[model samples]
Target: MFFSSDHPKHEFEESQQCKSRDAICYLCKNKVSLVEDESNAFYCCQGCGSNFHKDCLTVTYPKCHEHTLTFIRRKIPFPCDVCGQEFPDEMYGCLQCDFFVNRHCIYLPRVIKITRHSHRLSHVLRISDGDNVCGICRSLVDVGYGGYSCIDKTCNYVAHFHCIIRFNVWDGKDVEGEEVAASEADDVAPLLLVEDIDGESTWRHFSHDHDLLRVVEEQESEELCQACILPTYKTGKFLRCKECDFALHETCACLPRKMAHGLHVHPVTLHVETGDGFFICSVCNQYSCGLMSYKCNQKDCGFKMDVRCASFVEPFNHTALPHDPFYLGVDFNEYIYRCYGCRQRSRFTARCVQGSIDFDFKCLNLPGLIKYKCDDHPLTLYYDHRGHNSGWCEICEEIIEKGRIIYTCRHCFTTLHVDCILGKYPYLKCGHKIKVNGFEVEIASNNGASRPICQTCHRICQDKHVFNGKDQVCFCSVECIPSQACS
Candidate 1:
């Protein structure tokens, strides 16, 4: 019953006697948005008037025995019902039966769909007969509590509860709430505007300083397109710099001028030249790939984006994550928030609030195998080590903080500093000479100067990586090789 009148015994626990208008959540214990909202604050047993966040009701076991299981807020170690192992933190317990469940073990779905397999999987009681490796995390699945297993016994697919709902696999849907739009508007803005909509074909791109001339006839060349870094198509209508050899596929030239990605509240504006040769994309953690990108224009904010990330308008979809659709938002929540993907603080993140989940752009942009030259095989982010960011970087040899996300390869025992492996200026083949405008430049290491800066971004490079060109030391990458004529 919602109120005390339904239960004849008017008995109430101390917590239930008075509902504070500033009632804190019994589970997360954090101040909820309900502190001020007029809508239903949380789940309350009318008899006691005790309040609870609705999330605490459904994400948790709905019922224990015949009654609703109460959430234990205090941190106490107790044995679990499913695995009989030590359960920590918020546990679901039954006062009458003396039963308790690990917070993670409750609300375990019976059957579910995951991107790992084509078929639906059911919760298996145990996998005792043979070797059982979780299909998602690729670790040994603990049979004590069982796990979501493939329906077909011949196909051996088992995954831990936490491994199944990775941002990459499940669609971020709030299973409890009614289906609704994630944003106020669903329509997408026009990507780019043509110079002459009357079909003149010449285009003025937002990122480029020069107007791109369209190729009308077959004029094939061995030159590669500047945007995709691929060979120019011989038969396709592409755009080329009127003077320089820089070119782009027709489709690549029309990227959106501005977009609201799921990571930040401000719109990311497209830029042809990031103006920083040494700046790495925080999302992909790679060099700018000599392509147009979107950047957060807010002062003191360093957020930048690749063409791929800028294209995914709000309500960005993955192979689809089944909790809540992540959207672009700023963290004004009045509390610290750590990202679920990179396991870093939400300094710059894409998020789904239903689970209080935040993902780094690297995860939200694409949530699957990451290809890096440092490792032979693809490296993937593991949720097991998500919150434990303790280690030392192999490249820079700096101590990685306990809360930083360190991507690892279980097979080769290869753990890497995300930045070192996917660095922006680290890919240059040192000593290689290239021409920019009219001047020749050579790739050189930063000689540890007291004050060195990139000519483009004007940010102090601190003698990091540099391009020696006629007295001007360019610390940015060759993508924007600095030159007097080009200046």
Candidate 2:
């Protein structure tokens, strides 16, 4: 089926000279045949090779050298223009374009504009002198594909796509704040503008909620913010003007969006205008204008919040414990007796009341409770020392079962609550093997060590009995019970 330049009718033979056997000519099957003519010919079949004149083969495949007839293969590796990653050899590439891009970079969208700028910017293949530099850092962008640049010839501002989209901007005047009546007002407010840092033309405007926004100007002055009372800066998101710096962080500007207090079962909803006077959040004990707080919108429940405390998420980040955090929900029940984790009386601690009923208190210890094999028992539920006996439980500072006669395996001394032991625990110390009543149990020394360690907790075990003929059976404590047994 294959043909060569000199012997058109001969069957093809593997070439020892060719280094790449996997690479075949696109048109022919028997490694591409090389011809001595100026135009080298690559033959696929004998019929085609004999039909094509020597001149035709020369036109298709040209020889580089003059004296010898040699076949040469060329492989090309091109680098991506966008991310700079290289493409594979012999990969399809663009010949006419200088910007060599891999397949991944080829799909990138041609244009994108961010909200931080007023005028729309387009993606350009090459840098120009008139392009705007970054508004924030004032830097030139050379390689980023997803970015925005100024279009004006005079401006040279550009910004990373992510930076422009993630930032929140605010004008000094229109942010949320308390407004005093004309009789109590001391001075007039100043005009404030929120403009894109790159160019001066674009500005942000507030269409709704006007009363909370105000502006004031002063000369070299610093004051506690009328809002949060945190120090204010002249040009930052939260500012007190030099004329009369009355500042608030942009986050603080929108206060009391939602809140729930410990004192009441119902959650309070706060708005910018309806709050009465200054109040404090019952949860965190921070003061606020009491505006925009979550209060029992109910008439009979007289609970309230300051903006600062009302916005806190319940189950918010707790440093002392390792459990999933949660926020206090609305509809709290005040009658709950004690904290779930600490067991302290609920009246003293902030009890999260829900639906007028106190639910279980939050704690980190409750989630890991399960069946485990103990040093003393075949299978048992793992009980925290704190929950077994109140005294022991208190000393251990844990909550599963402090000081009670909990169920445990007699052989391993593994303790568990009756419910956890009967409902969950089964099988060997490792707990990996299912226990058949007739299944054989074996006891052996873990290696030659006098005291073998439990695989689960990695603690030394005085008992060296491994179950189900497993290589190792020692258990340090009840917590190391494995869920399944290896065969």
Candidate 3:
């Protein structure tokens, strides 16, 4: 007991790398350094040693292993220490207790301040009876990923972590983040410093009749005014009134834009207050707005119109009628009358009566009906009606056919149908010349007598004969007269 005796030593084989008497680590093949609990040896530093740290070993395993062991021991399963849930196999455990914790979960921040929300949010472990509903949008967060509620006990202002952070709930503005401008704010135009204002005027084109003007200060007016026309109380943003009531929709104030109209294939440009008093709009038949009229600027061409009316397409169809649509034409006459076909009075000036007839002939295919005779049979014009049809022969009979039928001779009152006399060429052999609108005609023959025979038909005229001085002209019927011959 009084003397300190040297510890008993053990000898190692020469092939072994151990310099001292000690056990070697099985994993690294290094010599064990120190003894633990009188039996277990420290095989390496605590990190690499077979002997685990108290906390680390207690978390991984329920009980500690015996000292001086060579093999690593298996860890036990337990609830997660951080999340209070069943721990995964890969989680670190404690040897002293049943607690186990995930590495990432241990370092997760407990409280986060988000820029989207108005209040700080804290990590919530679980829902409880004390927790209130979310303050924003009044919804309940019953389960995972909830945030810390407000300090008031009765106030159930719990918000989800996603609701607060994802939506940036701390931001003072609304979700759209639009900024509101101050009321009655003044907006000033930017000032340009010029070397010489006079030099700039030289380059400007003098297409407009008005003098060059510059803007002074912003004016507040609800009326949409034009530079050449008076102002009116119309809701529009464009309001410029320096020259005259010349206000334009901020859109129409700018000119020379290319546009298409129904009247022309080529694009046209805006023309403002340039034409003389006699200017006529191709459409609408009205005087166009001085500031908003559109015209085909082509030289020597007469097309011009208001921008609104020029947009109407040609051959326009209306639900009211089956005939071809007509547009109003400009006529400067004083008296106004309704068109026979359209039944509408002229807007600015009276339309010509000739326009009605011209429209019928050109648009309605009516002239063709007047020029061509009926296709069913050949008929000669006659005032007298004596045949089977309704027409009358002036010399003898009472009635004739409506279409084509026999008529009396002008000189002898002899009745014959087209088939009875001419055989085939009734149109050519007819002695009378046809005329438009049913005017009377005279037939003549070479020999003078009370009645004369037609040279072409070789028939004596039953109707009265007129002398043309060169020959004794005899009329069988007015229908036998040729239109050219009568003319």
Residue-wise C-alpha lDDT for candidate 1, range 1-487, written one tens digit per residue: 2322223443333333445658665556765454434354455544444556655643434432455665553345776765445756556667677766666666566665542354557765455555676654445777666666676768776766665543334433322333322222233332344567567655565556666788744554455555544445543777877667667777667665554454443446666653433235655554544556668756777877666455555455543254456655343432345666556554455555454556665555442344455678756544332346556666677876654445566677566556555443433434545555556777666655365677777776543356667766564655556565665
Question: TM-score per candidate, in order?
Answer: 0.36, 0.24, 0.21
Higher-scoring candidate on lDDT, 1 or 2:
1
Q: For model 2, how many clashes?
A: 61
Off by over 4 Å in 2: 1-77, 81-92, 96-99, 115-118, 130-140, 143-148, 159-224, 231-487
RMSD list, candidates in order? 13.8, 25.8, 36.3
CA deviation > 4 Å runs, candidate 3: 1-231, 242-245, 254-256, 310-342, 345-487
Best by TM-score: 1
lDDT of each: 0.55, 0.36, 0.35
RMSD of 2: 25.8
